[model samples]
Target: MSLREAVAALVSDGDLVAIEGFGHLVPVAAAHEIIRQGRSDLTLARMSCDVTVDQLIAAGCVSTLISSFVGNSSAGSLHELRRRVEHDDPAPLRLEEYSHGGMVARYTAGASRLPFAAINSYRGSDLPTLNPEIRTVTDPYGSGDIYVVPALRPDVSIIHAQRADEHGNVQAWGILGIQTEAAFAADRVIVTVEEIVDDDVIRSDPNRTIIPAHAVTAVVECPWGAFPHAVQGYYDRDDAFARRWSELARNPHEMHVWLDANIRGTSDFDAHLELVGHPRDGRLNVTEAFPSPVNYGGRR
Candidate 1:
């Protein structure tokens, strides 16, 4: 399915959507598509919220954020996020703040099909004071108090990968975030890849298969899905564009104009890719410098 189709079919208003990526491979394209489709009152979940979340917030596509940290990766503060939280310019963004571990624990519990996961992340902090859900769980073995958080089962999760087969078997390299857990925890998973390869190629190196095909609901071949943010071995992060977006996001008129030209104005993902000036001439290709290919076929 196309990126637009995948999001339209899987996501709806008032849905909890998780777009997982650590540093790179953030599903900005999927988020843009959601905005273009005019989704509203969405609760977005991310371990580390960055420009993508900021864009959605500016576009009025998100009303709540389930986040550990909300800011730009390199830049200090995401303009729109700050504007909404501080000024409530567009709308008041209801935030569910958590530690990085708290966010991860939520997904882990959901992936494991458990009610909640306990961690010692928010014990000493003031997070519990602000958010009442952060509670203490007594250890059954008579240990000390530990904090527990409810599982985050998102209505839909969109994950971008280096590559995937048509069947939706995703394989990604570089910094691995909690994407595997996020995909498993969501009710529906959309795996958007730079390219869709043959199953034979995907299975040749099984170690790269993070999310299997069975867990995926939709597969979209969206090249440059993670533009502006790097995709591991693919392109380098577009710092110029990121800086421009940060500046434009500070003003509502400028931000909307940028979104209209780049996101809403574009007809499709490919068109947006073209609009952003992403080159397909092997400029973002990855090279395997390491020559070793080990096989622990039968160590036991």
Candidate 2:
């Protein structure tokens, strides 16, 4: 299915949506669609929010952000997020903060159908004070006081992968990140892949099948879907573009102008790629590497 179709069908305003991919395979394209559709008042969840989430924040689609960290890479301030947190530029954004470990535990709990997850985070820190949801409980095993975060089960989870079969069995390697847990925790899962491969390819390497078909609601084949954020074997991150975006994001007017021309003005990701001189003249492409083939075969 097409990404636009998937987003339009499954995503609704004011839904708890999560687009997870960690550092690599960030679903920038899907976020752009969310912005393009003008969906408002959404509660977004991500472990490492990064620049991809920043785009959604800047667009004003997000009402509340539930995350451990909002900005990780770009080696500089994510200006739009900072503007909202400090200045309340466009609107007042509510933030639900947690530690990286706490977030993972929360997602784990959500996937496991638990009420909350206990972790050793924020013991001496003031993060607990900021977030009222963070609670303390005495360990039943006599380990002492424990901090726990509520399970984060999103209404919809969108993630990028290297490939998926027709049945929507997602295969991702390099850094699998939190896509699996996020997908399982969500009510609906939308997977955008660089390619749609045969079932045999997936069968040959079961270990790489991160999100199984039964958990996926939709599969979108979108090459370069994670542009400016790399897709492991497909392409590399576009740091220069990211830095340029940071510069524009400092000023609201300039930021919107760039978005208008690059994101909203374009018909789709392919058009955006064309407008930005992508294929990067073949510069962003990665070289193929041969790996030892593992047999997942038996007496058929």
Candidate 3:
């Protein structure tokens, strides 16, 4: 399926959607597609909540954000997010903050179909005071006080992978960062990849299969799906573009112009690629050249 189609089909209004990536393979294209489709009143979940989350908030596509931290790579805080929460610019953003470990526990619990997850975090922090979602639970083994967070089962989970088969078997490497858990926890999963390969290629390296075909609802072959963010083994992070976004997207008017020119203006992902410059231009090539061979059959 196409990126636009996948976003339209999988993501819906008021859905709890999670587009997650740690440092690499961020699903920026899908987020843009959501904005282009004019989906609003969404509750977005992510770990770091990088550029995509910021843009979604600026576009008024989001009403709530669930995450540990939200920041640009080197551009400091996401000014748009700050403005929404701080000044209530476009709309007031309802926040559900959690510690890094607490979020992981929540996703883990959801993936495992558990009601809640207990962790020994936020003991001395003000998260429990600030966020009511953070609750205390008694240890079953009588170990005294414990902090627990509810499972985060998103309505849809969109993730960008390095490669995938037409059957939706996703293969990703480098900085996965809770993608598997988020996919497993979601009711529907949409995977946008750099390329869709033969089933044999995916089967050859089964270990790289992060999200199996059964968990995926849609498979989109979107080249440069993680534009402006690094896709390990495929391309380097577009730091210049990231910085430019940080500078220009602070103002609401500038954000509108940026979205109109780059997102709404482009007909499809191919047009987006052309506007952003070709991936083969070498500007976004990987800094390191470590080519690890895929060992299919090994005698241990």
Candidate 3 structure quality by residue, lDDT tens digits, 42-85: 99999898888988887789999999988887866788998888
Clashing residue pairs in candidate 1 (N, C-alpha, C atoms within 3 angstroms): none
lDDT of 2 by residue, 262-288 (tens): 888988899988998787688888899
lDDT of 3: 0.88
lDDT of 1 by residue, 194-262 (tens): 899999998778899999999999999988888878888777787767777777777789888888898
Q: Which clashing pairs does model 2 show?
A: none
TM-score of each: 0.94, 0.96, 0.95
Q: Model 2 Cα displacement at 53 (Å)? A: 1.5
In terms of lDDT, model 1 sits at 0.87
| 1 versus 2: better TM-score goes to | 2
278 in model 3: Cα distance from truth in Å? Answer: 4.2
| lDDT of model 3 at position 127 | 91
Off by over 4 Å in 3: 291-300
Give lDDT per model, in order: 0.87, 0.87, 0.88
Best by lDDT: 3
What C-alpha lDDT, on a 0 to 100 scale, does residue 64 get in candidate 1?
91
In terms of lDDT, the poorest run of 10 residues in model 2 is: 68-77
